[model samples]
Target: MSESANDTAQPVTDWEGYSFDTRQVHAGEYPDRNTGLRVPPIAMSAGYVFDDFDDQVDRFAGRSIDPIYSRQGNPTNAVAEERLASLEGGTGSVAVSSGQAAISSALFALAQHGDHIVSTASIYGGTRILFGRSFKRFGIEFDYVWDADDDAEWERAIRPTTKAIFTETIPNPRNDVTDLRRIAEIAARYNLPVVVDNTVGTPALIRPFEHGADIVVHSTTKFLTGHGAAVGGAVVDGGRFDWAAAERAGRAYPLITAAPRPGLGSMLDRFGTGAYARAVREAVVNDIGPSLSPFNGFLLHQGMETLSLRMERHVDSSLSIAAWLEQQPEVESVDYAGLPSNALHGLALRDYDGRTGSVFGVAVRGGIDGARAFVNGLRVFSRMTGIGDTRSMVIHPLSSTHATFPQEINDRLGITPGLLRLSIGLEAVDDLKRDLRAGLDRVAALATPAVSLAG
Candidate 1:
């Protein structure tokens, strides 16, 4: 007998039409029939046993979607993948080893050698590096549009070989929110699918699909995992992109829309709305072998249970702290869109309800000296190179994440000597404020004159 057939209480598999809070807790959770385990247990097996010879053949022949190897899929990871897909309103999702892997797999399925991709210039520093170095080495070209609003710039960048348009929902170190609707419109004109990295802006704050994105990627290591414990990533298929339409328009995605063998059908034909995600799993992730560990997969599902509750605290604290930082005398500027004075505040109000996100940039009065002093003075905020953590963290972007970039690129990105990226955590608001004040005090002291040695 099947696990569900024998169990008295069946798991809630379909999370559609449920509230975000309800789905996050209950969606994708399967009851353990053998032991009646309340929570989904870690599926540690590398392979599953088949009942007979035909069962194994059917799986290999694409007649069934059963897992043949842990490298492609895992039950523990499936819970997290399904929960995330439901949360993001996608048809399906694929979990991977890291955010970079998710991005690489998502794009590799769409564009291969000789193909090109257009991206919004403002994105994660690591992503930019990946595109410039590894993707370039693979013969996959990338063109960047500095201004998303400028149709001319976008037109100039997008070419006949362009397979997709890439961007971020809430780009960090500078919380400048992208206008997904506008980009989607541009993409529709060219029949290109829009791939968005909703890493900084988790589904709690913004569902990119709702705003017209065709695909969504996440660095589950950050906000989705909630804690700093596990490092994982996921790619969600919005299920709305018309694959046939894009192919007709001359941008072919063979991995998703083409068949693998003489007798087999295409992923699009077999899976319909879920084709892209299946292609990412079978074609890219399986071949490259960036499978997420079941151990981290367990942590991912558990972390998502309290996503909304954690995000509320994260955004609430960020709004308060951004406002406070803007008023500090030693602070040069704040890059949080939640601040009314910010250039992107209008966009933030329109889409994000003024709660942009926790990670943002703050420039102190002094140059690198002020940044060094401020970083050294912070007792509460950690001096680190990560964002979206439960603990408040600070890092000088110009000297760290953006260090390898050319001076011109850093200048364009506004990564100045004194600019520091702050990832606010679930810590007390007052304590976080005090920590900022201490950092500012250090910056203020940089300008203070000392007594003459002669005296």
Candidate 2:
């Protein structure tokens, strides 16, 4: 698991090509000066003190960079945002309330009434619903590339109103590896900026910007925080997309290029290279009120300090458990991409240098009934909807995460009744295997039950 060169970051400073571990510990942060505290303290203020009336005017007028209200920004949250931005190789970032808010804000900032987005059919069920239900109600439309590997599909679905291309770095459960470079290539022809959900493939595993992603987002509740304690999200701008140029070339992104009002300039005109990020912060996050609390930001930053270590163990344990499960007689199949037999193994190797992500699907020999027994048999693994937690968790998607979806949609997503999504955690590999084996043993018993039905 640790053989790959890309899996481990080189030991160096952030500027001198810092390793992943180094950045995790020191990126976008430094010791305090006023009190000279080694570990920085969280700023718990609701608002900052204005120097005077002129200072207030300057802040409101965009002349001052100092924070105004906690609803808009906070010092502690700012550190987390910058830390994530640096780790993801982004020029700027804005932390939001949750991963959902991050995705919502980014989408809303990029489009409005009558605009559209091109996305992969494979996405988080929550995001699929958000795009299908909430965003649709906003008068915006969505066009999904059911098969993103096909270049023609992406090209065909993109309309002039298509404002952005969305995809996940590593789609959950299915473990389907997205050809990020391929999708970015397809989006480039249309002058579209690719927005990648990097929650699964956090920067420690694979840096999407290195593969041409224009924007990166994270559900800090997941691996970025390395624990399930904090619920937060962030949007990171690569600052590589030329919004003004795209609009000039007829691939218009009105949210960026169009003037906000009759006289005022557009985001692109105001912020230059940081147009998208600025809009996400000022127009969407600020106005819509999905602000991340400073306390949560401090927690997220602390979690990031151990991100590299957690990711390393998570990958190793996941590979171990997946391999052991494949050998079990009660196991039908495992959808882990790290295994050589899986279809996306090569892609994962190339993208991550050998670390397949921790989340994947496991299908027991029995169907939904078998799934129920399997989950019921587990002792150490917690059955929950969240992923990337320090404690291992299990979720039955057909009845949990995607239970509300129609049968056809579930089938389309390959979410069979027997499939149980396992988020492998930081537990000992052998212990995890034993726990799974115990479930498999019960799975066989479930099939041959002693039902005393006296008719």
Give the per-residue lDDT digits (tens) of candidate 2, residues 1-455. Answer: 45687776553324437766777777767557688776668989989899999999877775566878888888788778878888888888999999999998888877889989998988888888888899989998998888877867877899888889999988988888788999988888888889999999899888889999999988999998877988999999999998877878777767777777765678787777677888788778879999998888999999999988889999988888888888888999998888988888999889987687899999987799889889998998998889999999999988877888889888998999899999999988888888888888889997786989999
Candidate 1 stretches with Cα past 4 Å from truth are 1-10, 453-455
Which residues of candidate 2, in runs, are more than 4 Å off? Answer: 1-16, 258-266, 449-455
Model 1: per-residue Cα lDDT over 304-387, one tens digit each: 999999999999999999898888899999999999999988899999999888999999988999999999999999898788
Candidate models: Cα lDDT each: 0.93, 0.86
| Local error of candidate 2 at residue 342 (angstroms) | 0.4
In model 2, state the lDDT of residue 339.
90
List clashing residue pairs in candidate 1: none
What's the CA error at residue 397 for candidate 2, in Å? 0.6
Best by lDDT: 1
Q: State residue 453's C-alpha deviation in candidate 1, in Å.
A: 6.3
lDDT for model 1 comes to 0.93
* Cand. 2 Cα-lDDT: 0.86
Could you tell me every candidate's TM-score relative to the true structure? 0.97, 0.93
